[model samples]
Target: MAAPARPYRIGTGAGFSSDRLGPALDLVRDGRLDCLVLECLGERTVAFAHRDKRADPAKGYNAHLEKRLKQLLPLCRAKGTRIITNMGAANPRAAALKTVEIARALGLTGLKVACIEGDDVSAIVPMSTPLYDEPGTLADVGLQLVGMNAYLGADAVLPALEAGADVVIGGRLADPSMFLAPLMHHFGWRADDAALAGAGTLVGHLMECGMQVTGGYFADPGVKEVDRLADCGFPIAEVAADGTAVITKLEAAGGCVTPATVKEQLLYEVHDPARYLTPDVTADFSRVRVEEIARDRVRVSQASGRERPASLKVTVGFDDGWHGEAGVSYAGPGAQGRGELAARIIEERIRKAHAVAADLRVDVIGASSLFATAGLKAQAAQDVRVHAAMRSRNREDIETLLWEVESLLCCGPAGGGGYRGAITPCVMTKSVLVPREKVRPTLEVMIA
Candidate 1:
């Protein structure tokens, strides 16, 4: 494809489900973006939202949906920057309506909000879809199913853009597709152009994490120190029609965007470098090229891809069990030894009381916890904390296990203090594959 007359600027507003709101607002107010996207929601996040929908239908979408739209609608309207987001989680329709309400409340008339849906395949998933990793189909574990959603792609989002939507809301669309759709819509790129789509997808992946490509998670303190981390700005990609992109944050923005940061993000959460599968295309990152073309700017190009996958990856969430945890603090001399002894006491007490959980752990927070104690002894910490956790099939088992640890405050360790415990419902997740044709996503518009 020939290069466009001018590159399109896309700004990543939100990376995850609970990213900071102020930085995203900064992007809309000042980033000069053609499209602003919030790539919220993880694999199991929609499933959790599904359970929320079951309790109260209006509560499934992003909690800050109204507040965000109310604040940005007028600004985005004035800037002519379209907004795209996967904040819909399990309920895009509700999200669309909520946006309308916010717009009307702000007296912003003639605003078009589009809701993208049909990604939920929970009803049909139990028919024949088998787990991607483990054996057996969803029917075998139907009783345990909490929620199921198929990952949708860019094609599913194009119609909303075509509808002249001021804002687009999506439920469980792929993370990159929120940014990829605008690129496809603006450039008129064919869906099957694997290389072009791959390039765009690469840009989406890089920017999807918001500040990660701009040094949020890349900061390593002394080794990879960054500037003004508290005020770190989200990334913006200037994407050419050829699918090449230059990543950078706003001038005077607080984060680094060196080739080192960009390079690390390229491989984050990537399972297979050769076949990074997505609903839009199977991107090949093996031969991709990255270079620092300017200060705080990195150019990404030559991302090749093959044919798209026939099946969509489906994430299934179910009731894992119960998890109960409790913690205590040890201080002064011999704190580490006291912490270790407290952990052992909790484990032994649970075992003796027949409240031992199926899986149990005692962690010494200060010494020999993360690395595990397997070798020679080490010096005691000035202060140490002991945390114990247990997982079981029911709340009673977990609670029983936690109570044993909580009792340690008075009955077990000498310096045991600050006791705390809780029993919470735990959800497990598994992956499966469903035919691409089965999803059948749709886009519907709501105007205010």
Candidate 2:
């Protein structure tokens, strides 16, 4: 006989940080939640991973996530709760093996752990093509691609749960997968079940950001005396088989889950409400309804989702042209005047050298420099400081820009002497977008 259908309480833990583990485990133990979802990798995390991997090949997965998992995994297993996390980052297999080792060290054997991967973009991007579009090729604006992560949908995770994994982990999957997997497991929802898929998507969207859907992002006037924000609890979704969920937080936790908070999170980073795209399905956010409930809870219901496409979109990174910036500070009497003169001197020197800096930013600290010019009158600062930064598309241009700064110290105002330090050169990579069909998901089952 199949396991009985159970109402699942899904909680999304905060991003990869050691400090959040104790409280997250406490909520799981106290609330008896069915599943825990942890989101860790981001743009900054990807950059950090790339740098660390270059320094040491073994360093790929976020260490903080591993630390948290070590403490929570055994406790969760003891409490009969499953976990789905996207803490794998660039190395899902390695992460899975490490987790299994941790479980073994804890004297927990025969624990089923599943790893979902194949969302890498490193090999697909072409060497000739720029990561971002050049002028007239794709668009006038170009975005620098520090890291490209695939937004894999929940399908990859369902198989793991069906295979009887107590814990499932993935690398760079969409935020919603963490919540959707538990729903699929408890309800036995098929891949093409549009209504159930839509419901799961709604639940995932509502609680994906943890505290954001509760009271952390709320701007409601009815809320009062929200205390202990430092200890604010993350959001949880109690999902029923009928495709509806009650969004709430831990009991005795800070923050309030009002309709306003739900609405704010619904709109966060969403480009189009009617056609919010995900790997599993195209969710129609316009149909979502939020109702306030008693005691800091809200009902999220009536969302519609369309069928998912055959493949996923992949983000790839490659070598872009080199660029860097140099900056110096000026402070004291007549600092503003000296900084302005120094800027002019540097500009003249760059012009004389025939090097064009792609971008330049100048700031006069405390001078109210552009308030009047921008139609806001304000007092001019008595003692001001100035900071300037410049960027270019090539290393030679940057080197020339750095050389011009030293000349300003001698030719510009005497107060310019405050400027000091060696200008350093920074290199950035270009990234490309590819289709998911090009990347294959690697699956591994480990026995703990």
Model 2 RMSD in angstroms: 5.2
State each model's C-alpha RMSD to the native: 2.0, 5.2
Residue runs of model 2 more than 4 Å from their true location after superposition: 1-6, 15-22, 47-51, 121-149, 217-226, 320-358, 364-387, 390-439
Whole-model lDDT per candidate: 0.86, 0.69
For residues 58-98, could you state the per-residue lDDT of candidate 1 as single tens digits? 87998777777777888899899999999999888888889
Per-residue lDDT for 1-448 in model 2, tens only? Answer: 9874566888777644233665587677776788888887664455556555566666677687667778888888888888788777766777788889889998889988999986765555443434444333212225344445566777678778888898887887777767776788788788788767777888887777777765665543565445566667787788888778888887777777878778888878788887776787777788888898777778888887887765565444322444444444567665666666666666666766665745655555565445625755224344554455566566676666665665556665675544542444333433344555776666788999
Candidate 1 Cα outliers beyond 4 Å, as residue runs: 1-4, 373-378
- Deviation (Å) of 157 in candidate 1: 0.2
Query: What TM-score does prediction 1 earn?
Result: 0.96
Best by the TM-score measure: 1
Clashing pairs in 1: none
